[model samples]
Target: MTQRTNVVVIGGGQAGLAAGYHLRRLGIEHVILDAQAAPGGAWQHTWDSLRLFSPAQYSSLPGRLMPSQEGELYPDAAHVVGYLADYEKRYELPVQRGVRVSAVHRDGAQLRVEGDADDWRARAVVSSTGTWTRPFIPAVSGRREFTGRQLHTVQYQAPAEFTGQRVVVVGGGNSGAHIAADLAHAGVDLTWVTQRPPRYLADDIDGRALFDVATARRRALEAGHTDTGGVASLGDIVAIPPVRAARDAGLLRAKPMFTRLTTTGVEWADGTRADVDAVIWCTGFRPALAPFASLRLRATWGHIATAGTRALDEPRLHLLGYGDWTGPAPATLIGVGRRPARETARQIRELLA
Candidate 1:
C-alpha cells in the first residue's frame, strides 16, 4: 500500500527543509525524504576547511537563525549541519531519513515516489536534491593516461594528505580557490588553472551583499537591461579572510587553462609541459535529477524547465536549490531560496486544498 501525502519534498537539505517548514506552517500534510542517515544534506559532504561566505545571521532559513561559534561570523559546515538537524527536531517536521527515492511519476492526479523500501503517493513533489553528489570534471585529452592521483572537491577531505607534493588545481570557482589555497598552505607546490580571470569582490563584500542585490538583479533582467556592469553576480568569488591571506602570501594566483593532461601533469595551450603529482578538479556540478528521468521534462541544459520554481511542463513538480536558473540564488545558504520555498509550499497547498 502506498502512503499518501499532500506534498513530498525530495531532499532534506536546506531547500527541502525550507519547503517542509512552510508546508507545516500551512497545516499541510507533507514528508521530506532524505537518503542520508543523518541531517546536513550536502553540508556533510563539504571539505573540512569549507566555510559559508555569509555570516550566521545571513545564512539562516525562514524560522531560525543559524548559530556559530561565539566570535565567529561565518558558520562552518558542521555547525550548519547541526542547526539543520535541530531545526527538523524543533518543528517536528516529518522527515524520513535513509529513504532514497528512486523514481517519481504521474499517478492519477497524485505523484508516486518509489523508494528502496517503500512508496509514497503525494499531491505534489518538490525536488531539492542538490548537486554535491554530481561533481563535474571536465574531459581533457590524456586525462585517463595520467598516472597521478586525481580528485574533485567532493572527495577532498583535509589538506594534510597532499603535503610536499606538486599539485595542479583546476577551475576558479569558490571551491577550487579554497582547496588550492588549503593545499598550498599545507606545503604543497600548487599551480591554479582557470578558463577565465577570477573575479574577487572587495573584502567588505560578502554573501550579504550578494543577497541584498538579488531583487535588483531580477528586476534589471526583467526590464531587458543587458549592461550589468556594477551588479555583483551571486556566484562571483568573495574575498574571505583566508583567501585574502593567501593573496597576501602570493599563493592565490591563476594560470591559463591547459590543453591536455600529460602522463605526469598537464600540457598548456602555449605548448609548455609541467610535471605534477596530482590534479584537483573543481569545475562545479549539475543538478541531481536522475531519479526523475521518467518525467522527461529536462531541458538540453540538464535542468527541468521551470516557471518560478514550478516545472513548466509538469505543474505538480517544483525544482528548488539547483541554481539561478530555477530562481535567483536558490542554491545559496542565506540566499533568496526561502521565498521560493515558501511560495512553492503555498502554491502546492492551494492546489491540493
Candidate 2:
C-alpha cells in the first residue's frame, strides 16, 4: 500500500529542511525522506575540520538563524549538524530518516516516490538531495595502475590520516585548498594538483560576498537588465583562515594536473613522474538526481529546466539545492539557497488552492 501526501521532499539537509519549512508554513501536508539516521543533511558527513566560509548569521535556513559560538569565526560541521537538528525540531518538520528513496515517477498528475520500505504518492515532489553523496573524481589515464591509496573528499575526515605520507590533493575548489593546507600543516608531504590555477578571491572576500554577487546577478536578470559582466564566481575558493595561513606560508602552491596515474603516483604532462602515497580528489559532484530519473523531465547542460524553482516541463516538480539553475544561490548556506523552496511551496499552494 502506498501512503499519500500533498508533497514529498527528498533529503533532510539544508535544502530539504528549507522545503519542509515552507510547505509546513503553507499548510501543505508533506513528508521529508532522509537517508541519514540523524536530522542534519550532508553536514553530518563532512570532515571534522570543515567550517562554513560565511559567518553563522549568514548561514541560515528560511526561518531561524544559525547561532555562532563565542570567538568562533565560522561554525564547524558539528555546529551546523546540531543546528539543523534543532531547526527541524523547532519547526516540527515531518522527516523520516533512514529511508533511501530509489526513484520518483509520474503517476498521472501526481508523483510516486518509492523508497526502501515506504512509498509516497504526492501531488508534488521537491528533490533536495544535494551533491555531497556523489563526489566526482576525474578520470585520468592509467588510473587503475596507481598503486597509491586514493580517496575522495567525501571520505576525507582528517589530515592525520595521511600523516607522513606524500599525498596529491586534486581539484581547484575550496575543499581542495583546505585539505591541501590542512595536510601541509599536519606534516604530510602534500602536492596540490589542479586542472587550472585555482582562483582566489580578495582577502576580505568570502562566502557572503559570493552570495551577494550571485544575488545581484539574479536580480538583474529578473529586472530585465543587461548584465554588466565581470561578476566574480562563487566557485572560487575563499581564503579562509587555514587557506590564508597556507598562502602566507607559501604552502598554497598548486601544480598542473598530471596526465596520467602511475604505479606509484602521477605522471606530468611532460612525462615527468612524482612518487606519492595517496591522492585525495576534491573534483566536484553531480546533482543527486538519480532518485528522480523516472520522471523523464528533460535536462539541458546538466540542469533541469526551471522557472523560478518550478519545473518548466513537469507540473509540481521542483529541484532545490542542486545549483544556481534551481535558485540564485541554492547550494550555499548563507546564500539565497532557501529561496527556491519558499517559491516552490508558494507556487504549489497557488496551484492546489
Candidate 3:
C-alpha cells in the first residue's frame, strides 16, 4: 500500500523545514521530500568563502535563534547547513532524503506525488522547493565552442580551486559580486559582466543592518498588498557590505551582458571581447516546476504567481520562499521563511478541517 501523508512538502530547504516544524507543532501529519541527500538547499552549493551579509538576529527560525551573537554578521554556508541539520534534529522532522519528486498531480480530492521510491498521497502540497532550483543561464551564441571551462555560480564551491586562473564572473546579482570578490582576493583574474549597472547599499544604517526592510515587507504582505512599488529590490539588498567591499577593492566592474562564447573566451554586448580561463554564470535561478506542469501555474517572469501565500488560482498549492511573495522582506535570507510557513500551516489547517 502507498504511504499517505496529510501534507507533502516538496523541498527540504529552510522554508520546507519551517513548514514541517509548524505542521508538527499543530500536530499535523506531514512528510518532507527533498531531492538532495541532505538539507540546506542552495547553501550546500554556495562558495566556501561566502558569509551572510545580513546579521544573525534576522537569521533565526520561529522558536530557535541562529546560534550566534545578536549583532554578529550572518553565518557562512557551512554554518547555515549545520544550523538546518540541527533544526531537523531538534524537531525530529520526517524528511525523506534523495527522494526526488518527479511530478505532482491531483487525484480526486488528494494530491499524488510521484518520486523515485514511491508515490505519496496528501491533502495539500507545499512547494517550498523555492525559485532557485534551476540555475538560469542566458543563451549566448557560440557557447558550445568555448574552449575554457564554464560553470554556473551554483556549481561553484571555493575560490581556492580557481587560483591563478583568469575568471569572468557573469551577471550582476549578489552571487556574481560575492564570487568575484572571493576569487579576486584569492589572486584570480576576475571580470564582472553585467548588462545593467548594479545598485549598492551600506551594511548598516544607524547601527542596524537594514533587516527592517524585509520585516516591514513581510508585514505588508500579510495585510494583503501585492506590489512592491516603493520597496528596494534584491539588487538593493546585497549592495551593502561585501558588494561595497568588492567595489572598494577594485575587484568589481560592470560590463555588458555576454553575447557570445568564443573558443578563447566571451564577447560582450558592447562588442568588447575578453580572453578568460573560466566563466562563472551567476545569473540566478528559475523555479523548477516541471514536476507540476499539469497544475495551473500563475507565473510572472517564470516564477510562481501568488497573492500573498496563496496561489493565484490553485489555492491548495502554496509557494513558499518565492521572491516578493510577502513583499520585499520575505524574499531574502532564512528568517523570511518563517512567516510564510506559519501562514501556510494555518491555511492547511483550515483546509483540512
Query: How do the candidates rank by TM-score, highest first?
Result: 2, 1, 3
Worst 10 residues of 2 by lDDT: 227-236
Segments of candidate 3 deviating more than 4 angstroms? 69-72, 205-211, 215-242, 269-271, 326-328, 331-334
Task: Quote model 3's TM-score.
Answer: 0.89
Give lDDT tens digits, candidate 3, residues 138-236: 888887899999899778888888888888888766777778777776778788778688766544441134456566656666679874433365344
Residue 237 in model 3: shift from native, Å? 5.7
RMSD in order of candidates: 1.7, 1.5, 2.9
N/CA/C clash count, model 1:
0
Question: 171-276 in candidate 2: lDDT tens per residue?
Answer: 8888899888888888788899888888887888876777778778888888999873323543468889988998899887899989999899889979899999
Worst 10 residues of 3 by lDDT: 202-211
lDDT of 2 at 293: 67
Against the true structure, candidate 1 reaches a TM-score of 0.96
> Candidate 2: where are CA atoms >4 Å away?
228-235, 336-338
lDDT of each: 0.84, 0.84, 0.76
* Model 1 stretches astray by more than 4 angstroms: 222-235
Work out the TM-score per prediction: 0.96, 0.96, 0.89
lDDT of 1 by residue, 1-353 (tens): 58888889999999998888888999998999999899989899888888888889889988988876676777788889999899889989899999989999898888999998889998899998999888888889999999999998899898788887888999887788888888877878899998888777777887787766775666677689873533354445777888878977998889999999989889988899999999999999988998888888858679788888899888999998877666667888655345778778888877886
Pairs clashing within candidate 2: none
Clashing pairs for model 1 are none
